[model samples]
Every structure is written in structure tokens, then in C-alpha cells.
Target: MPIVSTSTSAFYERARASMKDLRSQAETLQAQLGSGEKLTRASDDPVAAARLRTLSRLESLSSIDTTNADRANADLSLADSAISNMATTIIRAQELATQAASSTLTDQQRAGIGAELDQIHDDLISLANSRDSNGHALFGGESAGNAYSVDASGNAVYIGTNSTGDLPIGDGQTVARSITGPQIFSFTDASGNTTDVMATVKALSDALKGGSTDPAGAAADALESLKQGIDTLTTGQTVVGTRLAWLDVVSERRSTLTELRTTEEASLGGTDIASTVAQLQQTLTVLEASQASFTKLSGLSLFDNLR
Candidate 1:
């Protein structure tokens, strides 16, 4: 009789412990539903939790890459706009040079054209030293100073460093944010003479100011130099356009990858509300049944049987 009673008591103790476990599990499910996240602790699903950690880190890095890519794209756009403005200014200078080339124009008219060219030269210099979003020179490269500055003799000098600027837009990927001052504004002429657009325009302006031996030849040379300058600017624009297109492609790729990561994260660590609620209901039902059975068994006392 003693042995039978001890066995019965052990069974009831196990039943009570199981009921407590069911209630704890139900509470965990409720918390999961409230938070909208499963695997709240690493112990919930160790392998899934590890994978989620990695994906979370990657998502963070991808966000930074997207921001950098956007910034680079904006900077490139600004550079392109500035280059277009420079081209327009050059076209106006060319027009003035065309009028000055004519033999019919008087000294007074030529001087007035030169004066305008002077202003244009100054304008080009200002444009070359244009600031970017951060107030640094757009074409400054790594240099903190202006991309181009006038020396004592008044010739514009390239003061910036090489390799404009490169930004890491993604994992193992980078893009140049700008072009250098010399790439767009300076080039060699048809006669193998080294000249920048500004220098050529300035030279033409000086020649037109003075009574040269042959203003016609000088004007022709200036015209050729101006054409070369336009070509240089056009080439630079093409390069910038290509980079902008590349940025677009890369941005799309990054965005798609981010979406994929989110989906994977959801599968690995997110909750299923319906499934969790059903599980909680089942656990509660079992807990209630165990409690009722335990109470009935506990009420059937040996002394009540004897009575």
C-alpha cells in the first residue's frame, strides 16, 4: 500500500510540473505576439538567431552604402551642371572672338570685346573653383583649397590633387565623385601647343586689345583653341554621364539585395501570429485539463475512503 501511494504522489507532482511548463510556454508565445518578433532570445532558435545577426549586420552596411552612393550621384550631377555652364561661357567667348577676327571691326570695338573676354576669363576661373555640397571645390580632388587659383602672373594654376575623389558605394565597389580641373578645361591644341581654354581666351583678349600684325590669324588660332576646349568639356561630360548611369545601376542592385535580406530575415526570425495563437490555445487547454485532474485526484483522500 505504501509503495502504491508513493508512486501515485510522484505522478501528481510530474503532472503539476507539466502544467507549470505549459503556462510558461503560453506566456512566451504571448510576448512574441506582442513584440512581432520570434526567437526573442538566442536560446529560442540558436541557428536561426546566428543567421539573423549576420543579416542584420549586412543590412546596416547596405544602408551606409546607399547613402554614400546617393551623395556621389548628387556630386556628379553638380559637376556636370558646372561643366555645362563652362561650355556655354566658352561658346560666348568664341562668338566674341569671331567678331574680333573680322578686319572691319575698329580698335574701339576690339577693345570692348577684349574687356568682355576679360570678364569671361574671370568667370571661367570662378567656375573652375566652384564648391561642392560641402563647400569644398568640386574639382579639388583631395585638396581642401580651390581646384584652380591665379598665380602672380595671373595664369590659372591647378592646385588640387590627382584622382578627384572616390567613394565606397558598396561592398568592393567605389565610384569617382568628380573630374579634375585640368581634365575639362585644359588640353593641347592642333599645333601641339599646350593651352587651356582660359589661357587661349586670355591670349586672344590681349591680342585684340593691342594692334597686332595680323588680327585675322590670331583670331583663327583662338577659334581653333576654343573648339578644342569645347571638345574637352564634352568629353568630360560624357565621362560624368557614364558614371551617373553606373550609379543608377548599382543603386538598384543594392536596393534589390536589401529587399532580399529583409525577406530572409523575416523567414528566419519573424513571427507567425496565427500559428502562435493556436499553439497558445492548445497549451492553455492542456494546462487546464491537468489542473482539473490534479484537483480531483488530490480530493480523493485515503481517510475519505475509510469513512
Candidate 2:
């Protein structure tokens, strides 16, 4: 026979490669067991990783939207409360004006009513300049500071902008978060009548203090003006109530959408714990068997047999 070659390196190399592969699998399984997860890195499953990333981004956006909705809701609630208070104040003023309009009332009685009306006017002005959670004027439109200011003659002057800022509620939608004082309290009547409530109060106060004996006619006119003002404020309150109800509806819808998004995210990226645990156990068994076989082969070389 031809000369027999005693080289068994191929067998040793193949055995070493098998051992290396087994060790790598065992290490991966150990990591999975420790972390209670199947994938240690994105490279392990790129498709799942990408889906998880998308879900995470969407969750972040949802959180931001929720915050915006909360702010918008707060603004609307403030507006509602303000309007309600203003309506009550207007009604009180109407009552006072009616009392002053009676011909039987003396100048002294009208003066008392005028003083009270002045106080109510001041209260209304304070409400118009009320601040929100952000310390910005609630009825100031887009202006952050005080909405109404007093002139040299003690007349109420509007210092705010004309446009109410809109707050985004997501899905390409936005809501007007506030109404300006001018929008609610200042207007000209259908009969070409121009008046501001504060101005009316000032005029009544001047007439009363002047001790005019002919106060009944002026007071009568003020009573009609007070009625018109009350009607205007009531309309504003109605608008605010409608806006609050609409916000509630949108909030509920957003909550439902958020729940759906959470479920979708879980389905796309969540791990299967039972399957991952079973795979880890199998890998451990294979690794142990491979190590035992490698040890036996390492101890038994052809040279040992010769000995």
C-alpha cells in the first residue's frame, strides 16, 4: 500500500469549530435568561427593532398631545368661569340701574347705587385681566400682560390684541383657548348705539356725584344699557359652555385613540417569554454536551494510544 499519512488536523479543526459555535450559542442563551428577553440588540432582529422604534416615537408624540390637551382644557375652563362671573355682575348692575331709574328715588339713593356700580365695574375689569396657569392674561387675546388699563380720565382701555390664540389638539386640529374682554364686553348695538360697560358705569357715577336733580332720565337710559350688556354677556357664557363641551368630546376621543395605539405597539414589539425560555434551556444542554465531547477528544490523541 501507499505510504499512510498520520495527519489528523482536519478532525481537530472541525471539532474546535463546533466547540466555538456551541460556546457562542450558550453565551447568547445565558444573556437571554438573565435579561428575560430574546433579542439583545437590534442586529438580532432588525424588523422587530424598527417596529419598536416606531411605536416608541408614537408614544412620545401621544404624551405631548396629552399635555397640550390638558392646557387647552384648563384655558377653556377658566374662560367659562370668567364669563359666568361677568354675567352675575352684569345682572347685579341691571338691578341697581333699575332701582336708580325710579323717579321716586332721591339723588342720595342714586349716588349710593352709583358707588356700588363703580365697585362692580372695577371687579369686572379685574376679571378681564385675570391670569391663567402660565401667569398670562386669560382674556388678553395674544397679549401676555394685562388686558385692560385705565386712562387718565379713569376710562377702561383695551391694551390686548384682537386675536385669541389657538391651541393644537392634534390631528391637524386646533381650538381657540380664550376670548378677549373686548369681544365679550364691548360692542355697538343694532340701533347704531356704541357703548362699553365700564364707560356706562363711569357716566352714571359722574351724573350721580354731580347731584343732578334730573337723574331719573339718565338712570333710565343706563337701565336699558345694562340690559343690553347682560344679554351680550349671557351670549358669551353660552359660547364658552359650548366650547367646554366640545373639549370634553375631543378629550374622550383622544383617550380612546391612545389606548389603541398602546395595544398596537405591544403587538408589534412585545417578546414571547415562554418560547425564549425554552430555547435557552435547549442551548444550555447542547453546550454542555459539546464541552464534554471536546474534553474527551482533547485527552485522547494518537500519541497517547502509542504510549
Candidate 3:
């Protein structure tokens, strides 16, 4: 009364084994596709999959932080370069003032010095309107346009905002990306003399062209103003350099953190392809042997000649 057919049992067992083999192959392929690697998915091995996901997220976060660091570095470099250019211009102006201050210089000689001063003034104005890598005015105080505009009387006037915008660098930290023109090159001296470097340069140019009436005294006063301007710009450059050095430290730290996170992620989610392939081969061999045995058992006849 018991169902006893060798072929039937063999067929059912073979079908089951075939299904298992197909499932294994499908899983391997899925792992390769998802992870762009073989034997690296959770579906291939749940524990490994979980670890890989965590690592992937951490890597993404690190990448974002790296982008922020790069931007900060670029901004700092631009500011530093601008400050250097300003320093050069200030030095040149000082030299010209010194030459004009010499009493031995005749009116004709003073006029020549005046012509060069005028050109230097033009250069300074151009520098003030200098643009950054992104084409934004370097000292415009966050305005996206030219920092200096020429008035009807040919005076260089500040048309930008009064504040230097700060770039956020994660973890509640921020870096000042620029210095406003008014802060760096415009000031009121100790003697209550309000002087805009650009304006002063233009005034000097006018005086020189008009003729050296009091060349020695005028040159002496201009020399002092030029010195003060240089000092102010130098201070700004020092501050920017300090901030840049600090940023370098922070950037290096972030890089270290990213490497650590990457290592941990690999440990959690990574798979050994060689080991997985070896196990798969063994499983297939066992399945093949079982099928052969089942086939032979189903072919046997207990009473072939009983009839």
C-alpha cells in the first residue's frame, strides 16, 4: 500500500538539487553585479552585506568632506595671492615717493617721477578690482561685481559690500574667504586723516601732473601714507596665512578619518572570491555524484525474469 517507485523518488530529488544549484549561481551573479565584485553581497552572505552597506555610506560622507576641504583651500589661496599683489604695489609706491622727496631733483625730474606714480596708481586700482578664479571680485566684500568704480571726478570709489563672506567648513567651523577693500585699503589715520589708498594714489597722480610746487614736503607726507598702507595690507596677509595653515591641518585630519572608515568598511563587507569559488565547486561535485547514484538506483530491477 506504500508508494514505492525508484524513478519517482529520483526525479523529485534531482529536481530539488537542480533548483538549489540554480539559486546558488543566481546569487553569485547578483553579488557580482551589485558590488561590482564577486561574493561581496549580503544576499551572497548576509553578515558581509550589512558590513558593506555601512562602509559605503561612510565613504560617501568622506567624499563630501573632501570636496568641502578643497573649496576652502582654493579660496584661501586666492586671498593670499591678492594680498601679495597689494604688497608689491604698496612697495612700488613707497619707492616712488622716496625718489620724489629728494631736494636735488629739479621740477622736470619731479614731473617724471609724477608720471610713473600716476601709472602705479592705475595699477593699484586694477588690483583692487581683481577677480578670483570664479570671476568674483577678490576684495569686493561678497558682491559679485567690480569692487571699485570710477566716479565723475576720476576717483576710485568702493561699490561693494562692507562684509567679507565666510565659507562654512563643516562641524560648525567657518573660514573667512576674503577681506573687504574698505577694511584692507581704506582707513582713518591717527591724525584723523581719512585716506583711501586708491583715492590717495589718484590724488598723488593729480599733484605730480600739476607740477612739483612743494615736491619735497608733498613726497615726504605721501611716503608716510604709503608706509601705513603697506603695514595694513601686511597685517591682513599674515592673518590669511595663519588661517590657511590651520586649514591644512584640518584637511589632513579629515583624510586620516576617511582612510580609517574605508578600512573598517572593507573588513565588514568584503568577501574572499577564491574561497567562495572553491566552496561552490565542491557543492557542484557533490550534487553531480548524488544525481548519478540516484540514476543507477532507479535502473535496478529486483525481478527482471519473475514473469
Candidates, ranked, lDDT: 1, 2, 3
lDDT of 3 by residue, 1-307 (tens): 8997667667777767785775676567446545646444357668767767776776776676667667667766887887788788778878878887788877777778778877877787788888866789878988999999988987888999988677766556777777778777876665788887776666666666663467677778777777778877887788878888988887888778778876765555444566656666766667677667766766767687488
Q: What is the C-alpha RMSD of each candidate to the true structure, in Å?
A: 2.2, 3.7, 3.7
TM for every model, in the order presented, reads 0.91, 0.81, 0.81
* Residue pairs whose backbone atoms clash in candidate 3: none
lDDT for 48 in candidate 1 is 95
Clash counts per candidate, in order, are 0, 0, 0
Order of quality (TM-score)? 1, 2, 3
Regions more than 4 Å wrong, model 1: 6-12, 301-307
lDDT of 2 by residue, 1-307 (tens): 7997645687678778887887787777767667655567899889978877886787787777778778877987888888888878878887887788798887788888889988988998988898876889898988999999999988889999998888877777888887888778876754677777777777877776664566777777777677777777777777777877877888898889878876765555444567656776787788788778878877886677695
| Candidate number achieving the greatest TM-score relative to the actual structure | 1
The residue pairs that clash in candidate 2, if any, are none
**Against the unseen true structure, what C-alpha lDDT does each candidate score?**
0.88, 0.78, 0.74
Error of 3 at 100 (Å): 0.6
Candidate 1 lDDT, tens digit per residue, 1-307?
A: 3453467768777987888898899999999899889987899889999999999999999989988898889889999999999999999999998998898988888889989999999999999998887788898886777998898877888899887778999879999988998889889988887779999988888888884777666887799899999999999999999999999999989989998999998888888888999998998888888889888887786788685
Candidate 3 to truth, TM: 0.81
